[model samples]
Target: MNYLLRLLTILFLTNLSASANVITLQSTQDSLAKYSIPELIGKAEVTKDSVYLNYLEKKDLSTEELANVLYMHGNILINEGIMDRSRQYFERLDSVAKILKDPFYQFVSKLSIGEVYYRQKNYPASKESFESAHPFVAQFPEGIQRALAKAEYVYFYYLNGQFERYSKELEGIKKELIDLGEQGKVGDEDLDYLEMSKATVSVYLTKAYLMNEDFSKAEEELKYSDKILKERFHNKITTTAVQQKLTKGEFYFFKKDFKMAIPYFQEVNKLGDSENFGDFQYVARVMASIAYFQLADYKQSLSFSEAAMNHPIPIADYIDYEVEAMRYAYLASKELGLSDKAMQYSQKFLEQDEALKDTKRSNFINSILNNMEVSQLENDLIAKTKSNYVLRYSLIGLAILIVILVLFTVYQIRENKHNKEKIREFMHNLEESDKAEKAKQEERRISKANAEINSDTPAQPDDKTVKILDKLEEFESSDLYTDSKMSLSYLASYLGTNTITLSKIINTYKEMNFNDYINGLRIRFIIEKIKNEPKFEQYKISYLAEVSGFSSHSIFSKAFKKSTGVTPSQFLDFLKEDTR
Candidate 1:
């Protein structure tokens, strides 16, 4: 549970660059872009403010320039932990974007606003802002910005604990970005940005994969992160250095390798920003405190916990808002025999534990209620402005379109029926031979069973595999395997075998890898239902795929075709024709 917060924040950083990378990178000179946000640290605040003021004072800036300034200023403020001021700039950007009909700025503005609300612990507003930005995803020209926009939403999905959406959105990001590159929509300079961004995405995906408990994927993402960073930045970039060390620490920390994680945490603490009052100083300290506490080094744990307490932890990272330092401090102090300090820490932890939790939830609820204020205004305006002629014409057009669709659908249905007749003719041609073959197979099976039943003794390592097969027979009688998340580990848990042994059994007996085996079962199950159930005959192809345990309709279609020599729709149509 303690690691959950750490896990989510780590997932957010590589994707949410506008919040400055989950929040902000500590001040640095290495520019990721013309207006790259460097996290404001100590004296760096003055320089950032001066830049913000300069942008404000300048009068001759063009629309793009002004939008860039506003976006940068908002990012700077958000990174500096200035939520109110950040929200103002983003709102201003949103207004300007709407006036200029610039969806890019509109998207950026909403995304930044979401980050601000997220950092402010206003989850509902954050979610709303992210959703608002979603429509603008396709509005950007195909390039890094568009990919990044989708990636930013991926961060939100991950942090909101929507792992399925997170994984899907993440795959979309990779595909879109890589596709853009392959299509030559990206130049060399753009390639550099893409590479770095991909590395960042890979880094965060480790946390996302870990959250879904896909340890193998997590490890793969982590290793890819290391490889990409070494090739691109070579640990020279300050943010890169910090993120790499921090992510490694988090990875090991989540693995419960407290001792293994310590060195990486130490490395992060050595980084320029995490040393002083950088954004991650509190994170490093709090996590280090927890790690040490886990190691039973109470004195060191208490020291780090108190150090964490001394800093203002931002809401950008997990557990930062509620401040886990006090919880560990209480335990560490007690372990160290410091009764007075332990009591004080315990009381503070208790106060924060529930109070912060409730405050976050209530803030989200309040935002939700407050959001209804003027939403109907636009609807009312649209309603008033619509003339009867316009409405009538629109309705007429819609009716025409519906008629066209119905005619086309009817034509398609006739064509399908024709195809079905041909298929039936082919089946009828083979029906006699198929019946003969089936009769022969049934005879052979019955003879084998009769011979086995007449045996005096039953078969006894045949023992465990046979036993497992029996349980599997029982299991296959139910719909449990229809769960979309019926992974190897999950099946192992149900079968009472370790994952290793289960894999062996599946490979030996099922004659396929785990994924293929599950998919095979799903296809067979759906085919059986389609054959026997009249209601299921009316089920949409995608819905059938889902009920049959596929996460994607495309995948289900492919698998079904491979297994049965026809698409699900084709097979279902065939079944309908056969029954008639």
Candidate 2:
């Protein structure tokens, strides 16, 4: 009786295991049905938790089902940007396929692992993964899987700049696909997937042809892939379509047909907008901005470049795009006469360039124009347009100039009012500080009296002298020294004091006559301006003198040299050097 009971118990446990395996397998199949293999191939939408849960629930599945489920889980993880976790799933699938003696699954697992590495930009690891899968190609029967594996290998070769190897492998892949079709071994579903593979292969081939300067061949391949995508796939929003547009845009851009390239790049951007296409969107924006810039549409170029720089992805993830965007932004801003913005973008570009200095990617950027080249181009453009600009402005009437003068007067009036408010606030703060200091002094005097002791000290300034000195400091801080027409009487009246007391205080405390003091302040202000405003270095000496409150450039230059041990031009050169 006991032996019979144990036998039944073991049989029941076995059946329960079988039942659980069936349930899990069914769930995995259901999940996969929602997302086909073709959809999973490129930038597919995936819920990581749902896919992973299906994998976890799977139990005692057949070898093929187990491998498929595992591959699906890894592919979902890859799409979700969980690369490390995806690698683990692919590795597990590889091990399982090895154990089951299934070369097809093994090849696919290895290929998926390579794709993960490729997305991470781990070129060496990705290449090794592809190499490992190459040995299993013969074991893979002629079908969609084999075609995909071959396409992936070709793409890897193309990306690594192994164009010769890419060409050889791609020919073999094309011949094999043609033979498969003639053999009638590919059904409707398999043919659909094969078309996707062909489209991808065409994209890589197009890129290779472009890189080799074979424009005619590149265009042929591009049109072929685009037609196949539209006719068969109905121009669906797939990775193949996105890549095709990108390749076309790049083709036209390199050929200097920027207007022709813009539409292609825009199509790519629109497609990638809904998916996290990982650098494709970034490249699209950058290329579009470049095309617009080359077409001399500064506003559109600036807009696109700004969009690229402020993409949702972290800038660090796409440093190359960030650098390119900054370049276009600088160029556009400079052309649009946004001097301050141009300088800011240029500074950012330099900083990003410095960070990439020791990287292999730096060589790629170096292929583009450098800072000096861009600056020279800007200068040349300015020189070429200067006469036209002067002629355009000269056609305007004196009424426009008078209107500008009136506007400037209004601005000056508003600025003076703002400055007066700021001065009032500063004076209030100083009064508070003075009261606190007086409280401390009184406390000390009381302490001395309580101790019945007296000490001799120099007398402090009289109240009137102290008030004048405080007002003078306030006037200087308020930038009233920048007023070329300022006079002692005018300032003293503004301070509610007489000019003689103000002059006496200024001479006694500042140790300089009124004119010398004002000149020193202006010199200091201009030096600070040169340090802060990069555009200031480009100004003429006369303009500098006009803005710095001097009547003549000679006096301004002399005062600047006496105060800072450098002439204005010398100081400007120093600032330029420091920026570089």
Candidate 3:
């Protein structure tokens, strides 16, 4: 009877351990079904806790169960946008995953932690976390977790603005996700979501491409996004109106179609419930103000700016808005000849500048990390030496080193503080110089490219205008335009001509405004680079624009498309066909 009872007890314990591992998977699924599904992200905690409690009541769980629970809890925290707390849970999960001998779980936990930091805009920490997890992912066998990790790796590369890597990873992940969808035989909704995920990745890639001055490719990607969204699941996700509107608004804002951007912001404000409001309303209002400002509607801009300042929103977004709003307020007041109001806003702007005193504090703190690490190593050496050492002189040497180290650290801290002051002063001067240079560049470019008509009859042309025009044409022909940042003022200065003369020559002779003249030169330059240069064939169209002086790929593509009546890619294809 005793032997039979012991056998049954051992069997029961074995079953319990096996059950804990698989049972938590079901618990996670159920919690995610009710909480994360339908995008009820706000109720995640309540639903998650209830599921965990039910699971706990039914079975005695092991260490693996604890780890999985913590991981799930971290997921819930992430959905709530509580990154710091989510990181702590993931760290705990990391330890548990190591003990459970599951490298795959550890990789996922670290990947999630990296994602949280990424969302917080803590790029350094995010990069460290992702890179650290890469080795673990390599060790782990292929599965859903590995696929997700690859997707996340693609995300990190995209965020860091590594366009080439982002492109390759995006293509790789698309094939993998498609294969996974087929293997699982997942239904249309799941496949739709996976495709949407790919579209979102493509959007970020396009953003990087745009920044890199590859506008033709960026437009192509945007069209791809449009195609994906137009399919069965565009706004079909059962998310809240506020959240949906916020995303759509950002999409248009990035595209720089501020006219289309405004309605989405307004929709978010109109439909969003008050109790759930936090940063979204404030952001929408501020963005709407910017859109209005861009359109030169000063009244609406001032109204939106004033409303945003008064909104009881969080401070993270306000640091940027407050500074901008003060400028707007001052400008509008000056326009109305309200000197007192203008003076008040100017004072507020000065105060805003004073508030950013700690901008260099993080850099100083980061510089101390290596010193701290060395100190830690020295302390460990001393502790181990304490048990073995017998020499009084050895002890004295350590004490002397420690005292010297302390003094050196104090001196370095003081020096760093002094240097910070100098750095700030240098930065202030640099900013002023940058502003002056920008003004000069803009003036020169406008003068050369735009036809200036005074309300009175146009002033007589300068006597040296013909010579200046010759110099301008010569400058346009030179390789200097390949600098991309080469401007009319720069060329005028180089040629010893005034910007006005250069401008008059460009407008009169070329019949083009400053931007158009330069852009036309740039486009022609890019065309030559693509056709004559073999090395540049691999270069994206946007890159060609950057090398030739367009600010963004979208602008480059639009201008190119207008000129050729074909997209840059199509133009490239045409070039290739002609060459063949």
Candidate 4:
């Protein structure tokens, strides 16, 4: 049995490596490319170098041919789970396409980049990239490329868990593809390609629909994929494996048949590691834990949860291992009457939870601003280099000016001209060195001040507000509220004072409610940043609000309007207009 298990692991690894070699360059002939998918699933050894050779020998290729080569390179890399590399190829292709002035390449490139980020599980980055590109799909004059880019975006958005955006794109892509085909603007090959791609996208849409709990739509979309697979493709080895696994998993998950879902999850896990991260394995583990817990199988639930925490794949902060696992560990231990183990687990969990709170972004920023201490001695080397640059430049300029003055005074004092010149040069050089040294010191002071002011660090009521604001003078800094979720109780606890005392302090000094006081601080900070720091002008108003402790964009906007009697954007425009 052990020997058989070893063999199974090897086979799984081999299967994944083979799957990673799947190629998808647009340069391949339509007929040949259509068969490649099936052949690849059959473990055919088709590689990217072979595709490159085929294209390289073609002497008289059009702009379309080059674009296709780049598309293929990007596709293979993406399939193989190398996102950063795939992004580079797609970005290059986009540039080429833009140079050719083809909207198809432009849209396709954007769609490809978004898909890469989606696979990498960077949903925010993926959403931003796709939304930026989606607007161009409608403006592209008339091209099959536009339809293809739209379809790609729709498919990947579904993967990114943006079901609403996915559905909207789906409706738009279907309509446009049909309209283009009916008008005879797109060729037959292009139409077939769209059909095949859309079917693939539908598979994901089915998954998304199921996830959204729209069972009827999920079933309908899966059926459509099934029909396309049966009618268009001759072989179904690998595609069948993926489709069956997905369908079974979703079906069981949606039905809440946790026990029934176990087998499918097991099958997916047994498939071995793919060239890509075994995300499905982790997913299965998480779901199995959930299922076991639901079925009252505490031991199995704890075991599965532990396995998930150990999985090599790293997800975002959506879940943390220590927190989730410790919860299960404590509960399971207590239920099993292991009192000693339960206490140990609970203690560990508390310590880790405290660490997380301290590391939260807002808290970190607050610490920085409150400290107001630069590691000057630690940055001595960097400061020395900067000072040297100023010293060197100033000395050179002073030497030149002194030389000019000496030459001008040469005719006036012929007897003592050389002596006077020496004295003048020495004095001039000394003056320049002193000036440069002072300038460098001033620069460091200004940088330290800016760092303090730029910080959205929370302030404690116990700290002298006068001293805090005094430090702002060097850089003309202003305070922005740094804590959005901060409450009076929390503040009072931190400051070693009651809410009433803090309220009185603010009322007497700042003359405003907590809300208005915070907003006023933010508005002042924003204005100072815009006027003094050029780069702050580029930051979105929404980001500024977050940095300033506004909980949401709407609240930030309302506060800005109330404080300045103008929106943030309007304020920015006014600043720009004044500068102009």
Q: Count the backbone clashes (under 3 Å) in each candidate.
A: 2, 0, 7, 2
What's the ranking of the predictions by lDDT, best on top? 2, 1, 3, 4
TM of each candidate vs. truth: 0.54, 0.49, 0.44, 0.40
- Scored by TM-score, the top model is 1
Model 1 regions more than 4 Å off: 1-63, 238-241, 272-277, 317-321, 356-580
Better of 1 and 3 by TM-score: 1
lDDT of 4 at 57: 24
Model 4 RMSD, rounded to 1 decimal:
21.7
Tell me, what's the RMSD of every candidate?
A: 21.4, 25.2, 23.8, 21.7
| Positional deviation of residue 51's Cα in model 4 after best superposition, in angstroms | 12
C-alpha lDDT (0 to 100) for residue 13 of candidate 2: 20
Lowest-scoring 10 consecutive residues by lDDT in candidate 2?
1-10
Candidates 2 and 4: which is better by TM-score? 2
Candidate 2 global CA lDDT score: 0.65
Off by over 4 Å in 2: 1-105, 112-122, 183-185, 275-279, 312-323, 326-580
Better of 2 and 4 by lDDT: 2
Task: Report the lDDT tens digits of candidate 2 across residue range 411-476.
Answer: 977865555455445446546855775675565456545545544544556556656666766777
lDDT of each: 0.64, 0.65, 0.56, 0.55
User: Using alpha carbons, what is the TM-score of model 1?
Assistant: 0.54
Rank by TM-score, highest first: 1, 2, 3, 4
